[model samples]
Target: MLVTFLIITVTFAILTMLPLSRHEAWWIRGLDFPRLQLFLALLFTLALELSLLDLSSKQTWGLVAVALACLVYQAWWIVPYTRIFPREVKAANNSDSRGRIRIITANVLMTNRNAKVLFALIREFQPDILVTLESDLWWQSQLDILETDYPYTIKCPLDNLYGMHVYSRFPMMNSQIEYLVEPDKPSMHALVLLPSGHKVRVHFLHPAPPSPTENNESSERDAELVIIAKSVAETNVPVIVTGDLNDVAWSETTRLFRKISGLLDPRVGRGMFNTFHADYWFLRWPLDHLFHSKHFMLQSIKRLRSFGSDHYALFTELVLTADTNNEHNGLDADADDLAWAKRKTEDQNVDKSAVPQPEKHSVA
Candidate 1:
C-alpha cells in the first residue's frame, strides 16, 4: 500500500511540472486550472505517507521533499489571491456614490432554461450593468423584461456557446460586437458613462477555451487577449474588462494580459471567487473574471446563487478612485514576455482592431 501511494505521489509531482513546458495541448495546458486541487492532493498524500510509511529509506525522504516543493509552488501562485496579502484595489473612504457602479457577469449555460433564478438575483442586486454569456435568443427573450429598467443595451445572441449580451442603465457612449480571433465567437465592447459623468472603456469577451470539442490550441485565445491588452495600453481612459474568460486567473496568458494592459485584478488579496463548474464542487475554477484599471478600487465582490447554469454569477461593486500607493499585485512583463505577447497578438491579427459589423437585434 505504501509503495502504491508513493508512486501516485510522484505522478502528481510530474503533472505539476508539465505546465512549465508552455505547451497548449488540452491535457498539458489544463494543468493550469487545478493548482488549488493539486495543492490539496499533495498535502493529503504527504500526511498519509508520514503517518503510515516508515521514515528509514532515502526514497521516502526524496518523495517527501518533492511533495513539499509541489505544494509550495502551487501556493506561490495562489497566496497573492488570499486575504493575507494586501489588496491591489484599495478601499475608498469618501468616494461619491455617483462614482460607484454595481455590475454582474454570468454565463447562463445556453441549455439551461431556468432563467428565473438568475433573473431573481438580478432583481435583488439591481446592478448598474449586467453581462451574460451563452445568452442565446431564448435567454435574451427571458432577459427582455430588464429593458424596462436597463434601457441601454447591446445584444449578440447566437446558438453558439460563445453568445454574449450586455444590458446597462448607464448610457453607452458607443457599443459594438467584435469577432477578434474567431469569426463565430463574439465579444462586446463599449464606452460607458457613469452617473457621475466619468467614462470608462469596457471590453467583454468570451474567448473560446482550448479543448478537443472547441479550440485545439490556446493561440487564438491568447491572441484575442493580447490584442485587447495592446489596445488598452494605447488608451488614456480608465478601462474594465469582464467576462467568462474561459481561462484561469493564474495562467501565464492571464498574467500576461494584466502586465501588458496594466489592469489590476481585485481578486488579488481577496479570494479565488471560483465561478465555474457551479454544479461540481470538486472540479471548480475561477473561469469568470472582472479586471479593472487603476482608476477603480474594491467595493464588494461575491459569487451569487446559481441560475441552473454551469457557472455562477459574479457580482461586484466598485468605486472610482486612484490609489495613492504605487504598489499593487501582479508583476510587469519583461522584454522577453513582451516579445512573446507581440508574436501571439500578431499571429491572429485582425484587419483592424475595431468592432465588426454587429449582428444587432433590439430587445423591445
Candidate 2:
C-alpha cells in the first residue's frame, strides 16, 4: 500500500508541473486538459494517506506534503471558474432586447449524423447567432433549413473535422474565412450588425489539437491563437471570439490569449460549463467557449444538452451595455506574455497581408 501511494503521488505531482514548461509537445500540452481530474485524484490520495498515517516514517509525511501541494496547484488554476471567485464579466442590469445577443456554439462531431437533435435545440432557443464546428457537407446541407430564419451566413464545409459554419440573423459585414495555421483548417471572421445598429466583430475558430492523430505539437494552435489575439488587441470595435478552441479555459495558452486580447470570460466566476466528451462524465472539460469584450454583460450562460456529438452545445446571452464601471478590469499582458506572443507569431511568420479579404454572401 505504501509503494502504491508513493507512485500515485509522485506521478500526479509530475503531471501537475509538466505544463509549466513552454514545450508544445502533445504529451505536455495534453496534461492541461485534465486539471480537474488531477485535483480529484490528488484529493482522494491525500485522504487515503491520512487515514493510514504513520508519523514514524518520514517518507509518509513527505508523500503527504507533495500530494497536498499538487492538490493546491490544481485548485489555483481551476478555482476561478467556480462561483466562489468573483465574476470577470458583470451581469446584465437592464432588460433591453435590442442590445441582447444570444449565441450558441457546438462542435457537432463530423461523423455524428444526428443533425435533428441540434436543429431541435436551435428551434427551441432561437439564438441570434449559431456557430458549428466539425461540420461538413452533410451537416451544411442539413443546416440550410436555417436560412429561412438566419438570412446571413458564412460557410466552409469540408470533410476534414475542422470545418465550420456560422448562421446569423443579423447582417454580417466584411465576413471572411481565413486559414490561420494549417492550410486545411479554417476560421471565420465577421462584423455582425445588431438590431441596435451596433457592430460586433465576431470570430469563430476551430483550431487543431496537439495529439498523436492530429498535429504532433501545439505550435500551430498556439501560433494561430496569438495571431488572432494580436488582431483583437488592435481592433477598436466590440469583439466576441467563440468556438471549440481544442484547449481548456484554464490552460497557459488560453490565459495568454485572454491577456493579449483583453477579452473577458463569462465562465470565470460562473462555472466551468464543461462541454466536451458528453458521454463520459469524468472525462469532460470546457472545450467549447465564448469570450467577449467588456462592453457586453452576461445575461445567462448554460451548457445545453448533448446532441449525439462528443461535445454539448454552449449557450450564452450577452447584452451590450455602456456601463463599464461595474465590469471587471480586463487582463493585461506583461513584458513576458507580450514577448512570448511575439515569438510565437514570428516563428509562424504570420503575415497580415496574407489573410484573405471578406467574401460577401447573404442568403436573402
Candidate 3:
C-alpha cells in the first residue's frame, strides 16, 4: 500500500509541473487541458494519505506535502473560472433590442452525419450570427436552408476538417476568407453592420490542435492567434472573436490571446461550460469560445445540447453600450506580452504564395 501511494504521488507531481515548461510539443502542450482532473486526483490522494496517518514516518509526511503543493497549484489556475472569482465582463442591465447581437458557434465533427439535430438548435435559438467549424461541402448543402433568413454569408467548404462557414442576419462589410498559418486552414474576417447602425469586427477561427495525429507542435496555432491579436489591438471598433479555438479556456495560449487582444471572457466567473467530448461526461473541457471587446456587456451565455458531434454549441447574447469605461474590464498586455506576441508572429515560416488574396462576397 505504501509503495503504491508513493508511485501515484510522484506521478501526479510530475504531471502537474509538465505544463509549466515553455515547450510547444504536443505531449507537453496537451497536458494543459486536464488541470481540473489533476486537482481532483491530488485532493483525493491527499485525503486518503491523511486518513492513514503515519506521524512517525517522515516519508509519509513528505508525500503529503508534495500532494498538497500540487493541489494548490492546480487550484490557482482553475479557481478563476468558478463563481468564487469576480466576473471579467459585466452583465447588461437594460433590454435594448437594437444594440443586442446573438451568436452561436459549433464544431460539428466532420464525420458526424446528423444535420437535423443542429438545424433544430438553430431554429430554437435563432441567433443573429452562426459560425460552424469542421463543415464540408455536404454540410454546406444542408445549411443552405438558412440562406433565406441569413442573407449575408461566407463559406469556405473543404474536405479537410478545418473548413468553416459564417452566416449572418446583418450586412457583413469587407467579408473575406484568408489563410493565416496553414495554407489549407482558412479563417474568416468581416465587419458586421448591426441593426443599430453599429459595426462590429468578427473573426472566426478553427486552428489545428496539437495532438499525436495532428500537428506535432503548437507553434502554428500560437502564431495564428498572435497574428489576429496584433490586428485586433490596432482596431478601436467593437470586436467579437468566436469559433472552436481548439484550446481550453484556461490554457496559456488562450490567456495570452485575451491579454494581447484585450477581449473579455464571459465564462471567467460563471462556470467551466465544458463543450468538447460531449459523449463522455468525464472527459470534457471547453474548446469552443466567444470572446468580445469591452464595448459590449453580456446578456446571456449558455452551452447548447449536443448535435451528433464531439462538441456542444455555445450561445451568447451581448449588448453594445456607449460607455467607454467598460474598456477597463479587459486585461491589458504588458511589455513582456507584446514582446512575446511579436516573436511568435515573426518566428512562423508562412508561405506567402500559398495564401491567396481575400475574396469578397455578399448575398441580397
Candidate 1: the clashing residue pairs are none
Which residue runs does candidate 3 get wrong by more than 4 Å? 350-364
Each model's TM-score? 0.94, 0.96, 0.94
Which stretch of 10 consecutive residues in model 2 shows the poorest summed lDDT? 355-364
Error of 3 at 41 (Å): 1.0
Score each candidate by Cα lDDT. 0.84, 0.90, 0.87
Judging by lDDT, tell me the better candidate of 1 and 3.
Answer: 3
**TM-score-superior candidate, 1 or 2:** 2
- Tell me how far the alpha carbon of residue 107 in candidate 3 is from the true structure, in angstroms, after superposition: 0.4
Better of 1 and 2 by lDDT: 2
Off by over 4 Å in 1: 326-329, 350-364
lDDT of 1 by residue, 1-364 (tens): 7678778877988888998887777778788999989989999988887877778977777788888898899888788778998777776666588999889999999999988888899989989999999999998999989999999999999998988989999988658787888999898888888888788788899998988988788888888888888778667677889999889998888999899888889888889999989999998889999998878877789999888999999998888875654245446889988898888877777423553221122121
**Per-residue lDDT of model 3, residues 1-364, tens digit only:** 7788899999999999999986889999998999999999899999999888585799899999999999999998888789999898888988788899999999988889999999999999999999999999999999888999998999999888998999999888878799889889899988888788888888899999999988898888988887777677667778899999889999888989999888889999998889998999888889999998889988999999989999999999999998665667767788988877777777796432322222223232
Best by TM-score: 2
Best model number under lDDT: 2
> Residue 93 error for model 1, in Å?
2.0
lDDT of 1: 0.84
